[model samples]
Target chain A: MKTITNKKNILYSKKELGQIQLLLPVILVVTVFSLAPLLRGIYLGFTDYRLGDPISFNGIENYKQLFSDEYFWNSFKIGMVWTFVVTAIQVSLGLGLALLLNSKVRFTSFYTILILIPWATPPIIRGILWRQMYEPNTGAVNILLTNLGLISAPINWLSSFEFVIPAVIVAGVWGEISKAAIFLLAGLQTIPNDLYEASKIDGAGLWDQFRHITIPVLKPVLAAIISLTFMWNFNTFGIIWVLTQGGPGGLTRLPMLAAYEEGFKYGYIGYAAAIGNVMVIILSLMLFMYIRVQLRERTES
Target chain B: MKRNIYIVLILLVGTILFFLLTRKNNNHQNIPLRFVSLAWQEGTIATNKSIVNEWNAAHPDIQVEYIQGTWNSAHDYLITAFETGDVPDIFHYESSVIIDYAMRGYLTDLSPYISSEMKNDILDVAWATVTRPNGEVDGIPFLIESLVVLYNKSLFKKEGIIPPTIEYPWTWDDLQSAARKMTKDTNGDGVIDQYGAGLGLRNSANIIMNTSISFGGSFFKKEGNHFVVKVNDEEKKLLQTIVDMLYKDKSVSPASIGETGAGMIPGLFSGRYAMLVGIGSWGRQQLVENAPKEFQWGVMPPIKAKTQTYGASTQTLSIPKKSKRAKEAMMFIDFMLSSKNTARLALNDWMIPARISCLSMPEFKDKIGGWDITCSAVSTLSIGSWLGAPGYVEWKSRVANPVLQELFAGRMSIDDAARRIEHESNIVLSRYKKRGEVW
Candidate 1:
């Protein structure tokens, strides 16, 4: 009996050891490729390292310069506005679409799949398609509008600074709304039918039930989606770059575009890295706040 | 347990297979010469590929590979590669970036390699554009381009305006009158459907400088070899006058101010504009490929400014200093620039051959549909006249572009714009001074 027990214990230990060995490769890969590069980038941000030159310590000069740079500040303001507007619209539309699809409506599955097309397509392709659509003349949108007698002439959608950002946001939201909708739709599936039935039994109206049960239940998922979307929108460079190239007097210049222009076009790598580092800090604080709110709500519930 | 043993065996086999494949790839002895280029048009790529193939065939010891990237991304890609010490053997670069790269010790000077005869074969302007002030030939001269005034012949005939004589080109006043006459509201619409002229706001400084020179205004007075801008007096007035015509006269389209979809070159090709200011290389192709047969177009000689006309620098090929195959690369470049191949490549690509002998060749002239017209447009460069300036790259980025943007927005007067440019340009120059650098 003792020998048999010892053998069982040894077998269990061997299995556990084997499982840890299997996980080591994945852990090493993530550390090397993702975490190490990110940490190294942060370290490089503090140095005055031009391309093809040896790096040297610069202390707080880069940061100090960034603080006073008008272009940087303007891009930061634009980034914040972009994040807030895109996040609010994306979340509201996504939740609404998810709720609509969650109901016992006809063709719900087909419609859900159809909405995923934009999300499934590449961001560059989406940007290019939207650019063609928004072309001032000989574009589908202008042609349709003119035929409908909506306007007398074509609108310069991208040329005007006032319209360029919104035009980019329209394309950005097309992708983001689908992603958020899918996430919320999955969250909706987890809600028990009994909960809604109980609410109805208590004589609560549909709006009241949604306000009470659905939103509260979706709070955690919604917070996560919004935080992720905000980060993505803050780093949104491709759509704007493809459409405007931060042109027409730099009105549409986002933080990422500014960083790219400085680093690549202007050959100011150290300054660009500083800009990137500040962006990371801002995004990290935002994420931390979001996670704190979510955790706090969870504990209270 | 038996299934686990089979899985282990499969994993072992896979590892061995991967090792063998990698080893096989590593065992290849011929070092591949990688060439990165921004010239990715079908004809350009085909020509490059043929050259690479020919070189490889002759030199079996080395194999060559070519990577094509877009113009917008090529500079960034090359910079990144240089930083990483992975630069290709040879690359195509714009004239603006040559000094910047050469100053950083990224380019290999070719002065020591080429024969004097071969150097003399290249045009003097082409040679000057590629050579640094210190007499260092940092890049090999290949093709040369000059800016030309392209006007629609049909429009000129319809308006009964004689084209400018090549010997005595039109002045700014003549250009203004021509443009005013050309602009029309065809179909009796309140809006003007046809524009008189189109200038690329994208490179407004080049156009501005060209126009300014015609007004007898020099950007700088050369003292010995050093160039300094005459920013305060006549040049300022010339700049104001040009801007007034562009914005106040309303002869050009509002598209210059970002109102319409009509971009400069494409607008000209589509018959939306009567005249266009574009580079000779691009203009040559535009005439051949897109211009309608019945719509005749003629090239106007470079507009004169007090005995000279405005001309910009052109493209050159350079090898990276870090390249292991510099000898072979130089040989290939020399072959490409030979009169025979140069003419062949230039004709196919619609680029002006840098070789003076090839310029008069019938094969070179007849490549594009409108040969004499295009030749006459750039003939001013044969004489010694150009829009040369120091800190061209910095001036373009920091001063000229922003001020032009303001002008396009109609937010600043031409005088105010010139003053603002002078202020900002001084700031940029001061920074360069602090660095103790001229470029």
Candidate 2:
């Protein structure tokens, strides 16, 4: 077979040639557009490439700087905390809401639309609106709480180091819960109804049914949703930039924000590229695990 | 033979027609000049559109292409344009980045293009902003908004505290004492219903630097070839007072109030605070439109410690060096910053005219409220060359601000905060030091 394929004249069929022709555009696009820029970015990671300035190969200088930089490490810690907390909260809230909406309920459509309002709002707008609500004085949150006699003074939500991360997490959950719910709801609808009915008749309470029939049936979907939401929350930059600017002493400075500060504010393009390369490696590992699980689950099924 | 002759004839005719069309198109169309300006606010967007439209109508040979930009992404946007060689003919930028852009050889020197008379027309402080250390005039100042203390007159009267005035500006002692006295429990709820003052202490590096300057302190001293951090006793004293006001006195608005776009304006407008310490003339229009009609306000120079001082940002118009339409952009800049046009813009009462001659216009004097006091505050405007020092923004955001916030939060002593700022700033500034440069 190898000998036979080695001959150029072996392609004696027009149909095979037509299939190869049809795939050329996609191959060309990937090569020229996607792969080229990725390779160039990787090259930039090792250079001193300030924008509009002369660039030269620096031989790991950027990464060397990254290793010793206190701010970079702080940003990594903050990004991990932000991503983990936001993803956990969003997934839990999304699962709960998906189950609720999946049940018999009146005005299901109305509830769906209402829940989507936060998701429909742009991230920057959500950041601004939430920042306004978190205003120390004259904000809706403060005014409402004051009126309810919950506290004697308005809380400093965004500027207190202790409260800034939690406040941003609240905004993050508010903006992202609807997206998770919608995705999980779609997955939930795909599960067979007979499984739940069968479980109920077999002396299973609601909790038992959820633990056995619901969770087992929806495991793959849940995994996929969680992974996707994890990536989304991990890569979030606009909301934090708009709301806090990674401030109140850099409490909310995610890796992305730190990268922007290094590249744009400090004009350290090479250092920024090194940080981005690290993020890409982390995200790639996550995606690799997700893909492995997907393949394994498919083979098992 | 007949087919070949027809094909040759057709090709010849097509080539002739294409050349004719190209020539006609090139001769008839105007040169396109792209201009980018701030569009993050409705007022600015409207103003930019109006000015562009007026300019286009008047200059038939030069068509203006307007691009709206936001402050959050403007730096990256402009820099990307430069890297890609697609720079705009003209762009509006904050004064902070003018030195950086000029140093990078992005901005065209305007001194050759500008007349001495035109240069002399602008305020000295405003002109100093665009003039680089190498004496290159790289930008034209279009607007200047001087910082001042804005106070609610009604609250002061009710508290039996005298309002600050230009002639009798509040001293640091008077400011604190008055602020303490004005803190009140209006509703008998056992809680202070009103804050005495609101100074933006969160993420306000400019305000802090200006405050330190006012207290007779300098953040950096010029050595033979580099800047050395010199913020010592005076700066610590200045920060201690602010921290005391926030944590001990509790007479000031919460530091968190400064973290939002609403800023202290909302607090002052809602009567939650009697005074706003570091607001500019830009906030004057907001107060006029949003403050209750019964709520009267006054403007005074910033509080004096050993000296009366504040910082000013002169929004600038610059022509990119790579712009094909540099001459046209200069023309547009001149037209925009002309005395009549500056005065007209000042009539909107949102910005003060950068042109000294425009400031003398009766329209600026009569049409704008608190215009005189805002202009008078310009004399006390101390231009900090250190603000434009290389790597200063990073030092401000990463080093100075975080340490200062710790002091304000009572997590660190004033001495420690000052020492940390000075040490970190020196480390950052060392990277930018040259052999013979001085501030």
Candidate 3:
């Protein structure tokens, strides 16, 4: 009689309890896969654990070593520069293309589809194709350049320290810009045509209307795109790895590549984990700052 | 409706549980063995397919499965697999990585399983790579690779330059002069249409180490139980000379520093380059498939410096420590290394069989062109040693590669590069020094 009364007085209503029971599979999946791995990685970061060896606690030695390591810092610097430059260029180009496509031009859909090809293709395939195009000889770019008398000789686009990073950036942007453009195009569709019509009737020129109406209207979309683009560029590894392998004297070495070399190639698993942990922290900080800025802007408006 | 949904969910969960339990039971009964490899080439695939068929045919109780991985990400994937305690029973790895894996205790020691007769049949240098300093063999010798000069016979004939003979093997200087003579501006367009050689220095450390060893410069000197890098006088001289020949002499293409996509033997293939220095394994393949019928190609012994020559160490097969079927894994390795099977695999794979008897098999000689020369070059592995140290992998990433790149790009002086490598390598080495491990 007491047990029946206690069950009846439970916080969850019968319907709510049934609903909660239905969510067990989702909860189990999150716990087993995502949460478990995250916890394991964090735990291993503080231990002197090799891949197959008996793990031992090492406190913060791995983290300390990372802080002092010149290579790690260099890679961080490269990652930041890469993230900023690629994101800015890709976003602006995407927005510009989006605006152009938004116009009532003939074959606009066909042109948009063609531009989307790069984004639709796999990143690995895109990287390989771009690498071929950037080849020093027999590549389309060099052949075209030489034929047009733009340059007397072929350029080693992915070979030199100076050119390799920029070459990778161009390839990365090629893939990313298309996606950003499509996203912005969708955002552009949401803006009512009457807003532009009203501005034009009031004798507003293209630049003024774009700045006052289109730019303000696209702010949220632009912010989201920029932040997401920055995250993507920062985490990019496949394109750079396939193209350069961070070569020509480590000019294009990024943090992820460094972490990879440390963990797998050299068997410094703990150190690699520490590098990963640092990346998580750094990326999280960037994300937080982005959100904070967005909130601040919203508050000010 | 809620009761009906709950009943459906219960049934689904029960079905999934039953399936998983049955799968687990089936796995246990069969003792499934998985072989993981990243050898994507046609020959390697053929060899793997044949091996799997043979293994399955021989062992009725045991079954084997194969997993394919891409070369670029295979090592990383394997490492993750090992960390998660899900390693394959057998895997292929380069000789350099064997030590790295062994040090991490990820490999099973195979010394006890290997017989004296079997050990005697394997080449000493190839065996040495798998053997730890304490005389524990960590892997089975799969194949041996040696460096040989691959030259375009037609290009040599066209230039009226007699190819180096077996009796009168060319020296490094002789090869360089020959290459300079072969290089030409065929179209007279002021740009060189033909190059003397196509040297790939993009993957620098391996090439540099091979060149250094051929020039008789040992990167490390064995002292008691340990090895110390001797980047002092002799090594520096060798490093400088190679850099000078590669960049200053311009015998190799200037574009080689940045351009490797034109293929490893582009010059030889396109009739633009006269000579290429590459692994003997390449010569074996050229003998079988790649050699143009219009032009006869031949192998020259590796160019002699102070020492005879050196080649990048070939890959070996190892059983991961986490493998449940270690005994069966050892048996598979033994079968793979057996004279009959090795010779059979070698015939198709176009690599020097690690087994001594298989290498001497006359059938290999008749199968392809230039095999005679390649076999001879490979046999010289008796003289040279594997080029790796305890921390050699890290040294490669931090010092050797970057320094060599600087050398190739003409950004740093050879002496400066050598000094930098020495300093950086010591720092890398010191980390392992604490563990008391030796190269």
**Chain B TM for prediction 3:** 0.89
State the DockQ, from 0 to 1, for candidate 2. 0.35
* Each prediction's DockQ against the real complex: 0.36, 0.35, 0.59
- Please give the ranking of all candidate structures by DockQ, highest first, separated by commas: 3, 1, 2
User: Best-fitting candidate, measured by TM-score?
Assistant: 3
Best by lDDT: 2
Docking class of 2: acceptable
Winner on DockQ between 2 and 3 is: 3
Error of 1 at B397 (Å): 4.1
Better candidate by TM-score, 2 or 3: 3
Question: Model 1: per-residue lDDT, tens digit, A1-301?
Answer: 9999989778787778667656665675678689998887777778886655578889888899788777689888988898899989999999999999999999998999999999988888888888899877667777888999997767767766566778888888888799899999999989999999999999999999899999999888898898888889999998888877776666778899989887777666777888999998989998998799889988988
* Per-candidate TM-score against the hidden true structure: 0.88, 0.87, 0.90
Model 3, CA-based lDDT: 0.76
- Tens-digit lDDT string for candidate 3 (B361-417): 897565245566666666455422333366777777777887788787888886788
Rank candidates by lDDT, best first: 2, 3, 1
lDDT of 1 at B146: 62
Second chain alone, TM-score for each candidate: 0.85, 0.88, 0.89
Off by over 4 Å in 1: A1-16, A290-301, B1-29, B57-63, B203-206, B209-246, B258-263, B305-308, B363-370, B376-399, B419-434
Which has the higher lDDT value, candidate number 1 or candidate number 2? 2
